[model samples]
Target chain A: MRIVLVPGVPALLPSYASIEDPVADLRAACHHAVAELGPRVRVLASSPLGERVARHLLGAAGAEESEADPTGALVVANGSAKRTVKAPGHLDERAEAFDDDLRRALVQPLPAGLAGIDVDLAAELWADVGAMPALAELLTPGTTAEVDYDDAPYGVQYWVIRWS
Target chain B: MLELGRHTFADDATLMMAIVNRTPDSFYDKGATWAEDAAFERVAAVVEQGAEIVDIGGIKAAPGEEIGPAEEKARVVDFVARVREAYPDLAISVDTWRAEVGDAVCAAGADLLNDAWGGADPDLVDVAAAHGAAIVCTHTGGVTPRTRPFRIEYDDVVAAAIADTVAYAERALAAGVARESIVIDPAHDFGKHTFHSLELTRRLGEMVDTGWPVLVSLSNKDFVGEALGLPVGERLTGTLATTAICAWAGARIYRVHEVVETRQVVDMVATIAGRRPPQRAIRGLQ
Candidate 1:
């Protein structure tokens, strides 16, 4: 089974679109990763907003939203949004280290660090990791991640990763 | 869709028709662009400022010296050809009330005939139809060309405007002009006093409801100046304020001297009216 991850960036939705896209590269990477997740994909997200974003990405990728014997899973989550003074949540000294740890957790074949993330620290750093624990059950031991996109363009850490 | 000769625009599209006066006695610019080179430069400036059309006029709307058809053609025909050749993609409009000058400009590659004199010339629509060009049919309470309103009174000004302009639009349609190529205007300050103009501005939606695209030439006219008690050069604020009101009322085209400011006002009003999306909204969504 294939599993893909995309950030729950509001700018990626049609309602928040601009004449010139602010997250062009990130959106393209999300579409690319989501398209690789076959027709029947189940969406997993922490909150309602995250689920909406995940579903929008799935629709944009021409994938069917199915929970009955799904072929793949789409996870919606992102790291710290407080990486700089210009960030949405403003500057937090712990944001860089927290995002670094999240980046490390995303690339590992097992992602043990993601499953064991401290919820309090993640909240303080303005990181969204509620959907990460589901990846631990979906990805098997030998499954490896192909990091398609990784950036902090808007002072928010977003990654587009595909696992199989 | 609005089929303006060589160009077609979506129904919801708002267009800016920048004024390019080729005469020496126009009210706003005076003689700023009277010379051919100066007029061409004006076209370039407005085009850079994102104007969709240029309304070139040979004679000032307010009466001064009597300009015959020969002089009017001399002023606008070659200039229209020059502009058409230079800006092949731009929608070229000639502001004239005479069918003779309209024919000459249309033959010179003008895309639209802006009859600001309220169709005093009966054959203007035929000229527009013959050239496959668009026409702006305006209401002037049946006033003669180059004349001002002294004591004109209408029982229902808005109703009169809607009826007259719609009838003119139907006349154009019956004269072989394409359905999408006809537009209506309630020629503000042409034959109406300040009170009449204000009433027209306040209830412009009735004209919009006629299912004809409405064009408003409200740039630094006497009505706005008289409303605010300001001079011609200081009427931008009042003009934009009135423009916002008209835009909210669904006016499609704006003929103006200040393109950039008017465009911004129209866009902002359209956005507020829910007809247009914000240009780049990331304030809280980021």
Candidate 2:
């Protein structure tokens, strides 16, 4: 089984596209990460926007959603939106620490730590991690993870990670 | 594809035709670029401003000292060669109604003949065809070249413009000019009163509907000056307002003195009409 993580940015949608792409690097990262998910996949997204982005990407890559015993999974979630003063959440002192903790849990395949993430603190930091608990179910105690993308662009932390 | 000399543009692309006057008496600049070096500089500047074509004219549209073919060729031919040599990809257009001048400039590397006089010389289209050059066919209500309207009245000015310009386009087609190489202009204020010019600006979409790309030369013309009660120098605002309307109505080419301002207006209008996407739109889209 393969799993990839991506962010739900509205600019990735065709309806919101610009003549000159504002989020070109993010888009490329999303495309690369989504392409790793095989032909038949299941989507794990926290919000409707994330689901839409996942569906669009999957549709563009000629992949389809599978409910019964999928070959791969696409997880849509992102780090805190409050990493900087110009961040969407307008500067939270604890955002960097929160994202660092989440990054460690994913990179180390600490399934229990991911499952025990503080949902109340995530809300305060404007992090969209509701569907991350699903990753805990897919991951195991001793699995190797590859981090494909990690950045704080537009003051929002985004990561495209893969685990097998 | 819309072919302008060696350059070819897709059907939906909007173009800017910058005005580069070789005359010392043209209304707007009034001898500012009458010298050869100055005119060349103007060409370079407008190209930097994203102009797709340069309409170089020898004689001022308003009546001035007579400029026969010899003098007109002297004014534009070698200059066209210089510009073509420097900016090999830029489309060079000579604003001449005489076929002799057209042939000479085309031989000197001009890609278009901007017949602002509404095809006064019948053989101009033939010259354009022979050189594989594009032509701008304007409607002047049958008025003589360099002569303004004297009590010209039309039952419907827009109707007359469409009929005459479309007929002129057909004449070019019959003369073996490529179908994509011909464009039509209503020749605002050339042979019309203030009200007539205003009406043409309002109904420019009718001309666009003819399926031949429409070119509008409304840069600081008398129509805008008269309508706004402004002088020639201060009509940029009015000119841009009319340009926005025509752009919304699908005018494909703009002939203008101010290249940057006209390009901005056309782009903004195209975005509003849903024909163009924004350049880097991410205020709230991020």
Candidate 3:
């Protein structure tokens, strides 16, 4: 199975677009990673906003949403929003380490590690991991990971990654 | 499409028509760009400053030196042709009240005839139709060209402006001018005192409500100067303030001397009025 992970950024959706793109690089990375997914992909989003973002990216990538044995799976998630003073949720000292731990897990293709994510501490740090269980189940030991984008833009940690 | 001669714009587009004087005796420039080269330079500069159109005028509006048809043509016709060749994509408009001059400029590749005199020459509309050029129908309250208002009074200035300008617009339409190509201006200081001009500026939305595209030429004019008791050179602030109001009120075209400043004000006002999005909004949105 092929898997693509993208941050649930509302700005990546067309409805919240600005005349000058604020997340041009992030958007490009998300599209590139999503395009690598097969024509029919299953979307695992945490909320309506995440679903909307995933749907837009999937549509842009010329893919359709599917659930019955999809060729690939699209996972929508993000790290801490309070990583810095300018972040959406304001500064949180614990955000950096928490996001670093999540990043290490993702880069290692250790989706199982996501199952052990500290839900209470993640919420306290403004990290959105509602879909972690599903993502953890998808992640397996033998998969090779490719990180397309990794940065804390807008004080929100975002990752565009592909695992095969 | 908002057809201007050979050019067309989307209905929602806002245009900045920069004033480029070809006459040596224009009130604001004081013959600074009277020379052809200087006028051409103004065109280049304003185009660089993001002006969508340039209103080239041969005669000054404030009781200028006598410039007959032949003289007016001598001043602008060749310049219009040169501008047409140099900037083929730019919308070139000529400000004239004479149908003879209008015919001459349109033949020389002019796109729009800005009749600031409120259809002074009945033949101007026919000329615009023949050339397939746009026409700006201004409300001058029956004032003559190259003349200032002495004691012009309207029971309701805004109403009179709307009635006269819309009538002139309908006249142009009847004369075969394209419906979308017609624009209306209230002629702020042309046939109005400071109070009349202010009232028109404040009630400009009424003009916009006519469903006709509204053009405002309130750039450092006498009304702005009189309203703030400032001289012509110092009335930019007042001009931009009024510009913001007009833009917020839904004016589509701004005939301005300071293209950059007017564009900034119009863009900011449009953004504030929810007509336009910020160029790049990431402050809280990100």
TM-score for chain A, prediction 1: 0.96
State the DockQ of every prediction: 0.62, 0.75, 0.60
| Cα lDDT for residue B10, candidate 3 | 93
Per-residue lDDT of A57-135 in model 3, one digit per residue for the tens? 9899899999987989999988999989989899999999999999998889666679888999988987779888898
Clashing pairs in 1: none
TM-score of each: 0.98, 0.97, 0.90
lDDT of all predictions: 0.91, 0.91, 0.92
For model 2, state the Cα shift of residue B9 in Å.
0.8
Q: Model 2, B234: alpha-carbon shift in Å?
A: 0.8
Please give the lDDT score at residue B234 for candidate 2. Answer: 97
Pairs with backbone N, CA or C atoms under 3 Å apart (clashes), candidate 3: none
Q: B152-188, model 1: which lDDT tens digit per residue? A: 9999999999988889999999999999999999999
- Candidate 2 lDDT, tens digit per residue, B1-286? 8999999999989999999999999999999999999999999899999999999999999886888999999999999999999999899999999999999999999999999888899999999999999999999999999887899999999999999999999999999999999999999998999999999999999999999999999999898999999998999999999999999999999999999999999999999898898887766554
Judge candidate 1 at residue B255 and give its lDDT.
98
Q: Give per-residue CA lDDT, model 1, range A130-155, as digits (tens).
A: 98888877878888899999998888
For candidate 2, the lDDT comes to 0.91
In order of DockQ, best first, we have 2, 1, 3
Report the CAPRI category for model 3: medium
Candidate 3 residue spans exceeding 4 A from truth = A32-52, A55-73, A80-100, A118-126, A140-146, A153-155
Candidates sorted by TM-score, best first: 1, 2, 3
For residues B1-286, write the lDDT of model 3, one tens digit per residue: 7999999999889999999998887778889999999999999999999999999998888884688999999999999999999999999999999999999999999999999999989999999999999999999999878888998898999999999999999999999999989999999988899999999999999999999999999989998998899997898999999999999999999999999999999999888887787788777555
